[model samples]
Target: MRAPAANPREPRRHHYVPRLLMKRFAVERRPGQFQIQAFDKSNDRVFATAIENIAVESDFNALERDGVRVSLEAGMGKIESAAAEPIARIVQGGTLVGMTMEDRAAIDLFCALQFARGTGMRAQFSALAEGVEARARAIVGADARLDLVGDAEGMKAAALQLIVGSLLEFTGRFNDKDLLLLQAIEGEDFLLGDNPVAMQNARQFGPYGNIGLGVPGIEIYMPISSRFSLAYWCPTLLHQMREGAALADQRLLQARAMSVVGQGVTRAAALAALPEIEALRARLRRIPDGHLAGAAVAADAGNVTRLNSLQVRWAERFVMSRDGGFDIARRMIADDSAFRQGMRPRLD
Candidate 1:
């Protein structure tokens, strides 16, 4: 069997390591007074209210510390209100160092509580790492796309790797703003350069390939995981769609058969189909603005059985909702142990 993949982080070994977070925040800035704020909630703080007030700078490179600065453009949003709180990580200079929440119910839904029950490695990363290797080979070998490299399965695997490896280094959140980066760079290799937020330490990778467009002065490198379909799974699916389209130009056989994640027929399309995930959206949106994890059990005896039985379904829904629809489903999953059991990763 193929050896279990090594951890994606480079250096492979490190004397001092930063702990992986369940909840985090990030910042990015570009020219023309535009900026992108990447929020990484660690999938842990499921209940943590979505903090909204925000602004990104134009020449953000000039910031002395990370991206922290007075809001030049206060975004009209707030994660939670008083009396009922939310979990939030403080971000300064592009580092998430601390967090806050309003109540116990909120805490119950966060990554702290959902650590295992609904916890999982980021799916976008999982799929991409498995997909890119194939695509990369398609680009490298043979004179033409039709005359090109390997089997469909193998090409998908290579594409997945390249994508995942690139994501591990993305500093941007999965949002509309990231498209520019995707447009500029060539998906064939490293996203190139440093995190736009920090022109200094350059670990972040996939810009989706926006570099060729000439983004200017500050070279931004983002952490690859930060790039793994942030906010929701919709954009992740969108990225794959575009990738498939690119493959189509390359005359890839399977490109035409793409589907939403979890809804497809073939191994190539399995993760693409997202039917059940689509079904649970309405129920999920009811989740209070708190943590993203409190999805095992409901807070009362009345919710026990039904909610528990629905845990896996809830996770299925959680992965599908492009908006806040699955957030409510997460609440149900957090309160029920039976639900927790249903959502397990399948040990066998």
Candidate 2:
């Protein structure tokens, strides 16, 4: 494990401009800072030079003032009506142009939220929020001639959506309701970054043959760290998806696969996969008597089967949407007698 930094803010967050886009600029790494010589692709002329971690108070003040001004204008109803039309245009144009306005908006919104919450990715995102929309438009416009379904253009769009989705879930903006909406909007097979089992399966299965061959969509694999982060924010969503009837068999299979992966990791390997286990542990801990003392005891005793059962049951109750199996899980966890006697087998 990496040691914690002395200063909580010692390691400043870094934002990577993709290489495809970076080629449009001159980039250099100085001793303690990085520099970018950005150019306007339209005119092929230098536009600006950006040095990382360098910002003046006025820069932040300007952005803050803009945010405040917009808010005040909206509240006063001066901008509210005008905002809707432009927003609708952005969404419609973005969809038809294969530009992900929602994704970019999510990034900008989350970054602002983080800054407002004093978590401080403020410098990084404040700068990004300035030109993100323009950059996204440039990218989409440039890639427009390429295939929209499975080409590099499509990959970039999917990647952006994945990143936005990951960030939203990471920042606690994702919820069970969001999951339901997402499922309805994008179909059940939409790649959920929080679903480690499904993600791992995708990696193991490799890119399906149909992938990139003109299928309507493609799955984008997210970094394990992002999925791990989801455990903190969307345990409820995870629980709902895990036990919900919508993707029951697939979810169960993925859960089992995750368990197997957890069992197989070596200490070094375990460090990497620790997040997923931690997520599982975090989800389990939501239940009464589901902490280290109770669940850990079973784990330490080599009762993997029992431990897994407990985890599944715990998740089932932690966010039971409707009755069905949920009621049984709830009763099993709530009733001391049932808890001590252990969960019963269902005959129905």
* Model number with the top TM-score: 2
* TM-score for each of the candidates: 0.17, 0.19
lDDT at position 338, candidate 2: 34
- The lDDT of model 2 is 0.27
Error of 1 at 200 (Å): 37
lDDT scores in order:
0.26, 0.27
**Model 2 TM-score relative to the real fold:** 0.19
- TM-score of predicted model 1? 0.17
Relative to the unseen true structure, what is the C-alpha lDDT of residue 162 in candidate 2, on a scale of 0 to 100?
Answer: 38
RMSD of each: 23.3, 24.5
In candidate 1, stretches whose alpha carbon ends up further than 4 angstroms from where it belongs are 1-101, 104-119, 142-348
- Candidate 1 lDDT over 222-307, as tens digits, reads 21122221111223333444554454344322333343222435644533433433333323332221123322112232332222
Q: For candidate 2, lDDT tens digit of each residue in 1-348?
A: 443323343223322211111211223455433344322211223323433322212112111222231111111122223233433333333221222445434433332222122102222233333345445557787554432234332333343333334544433332121210100121111111101111111122233432221122222121111001111112333344345433444444455566566554543464555466556544543332322122111122222222223322222111111111223333444554333221122211
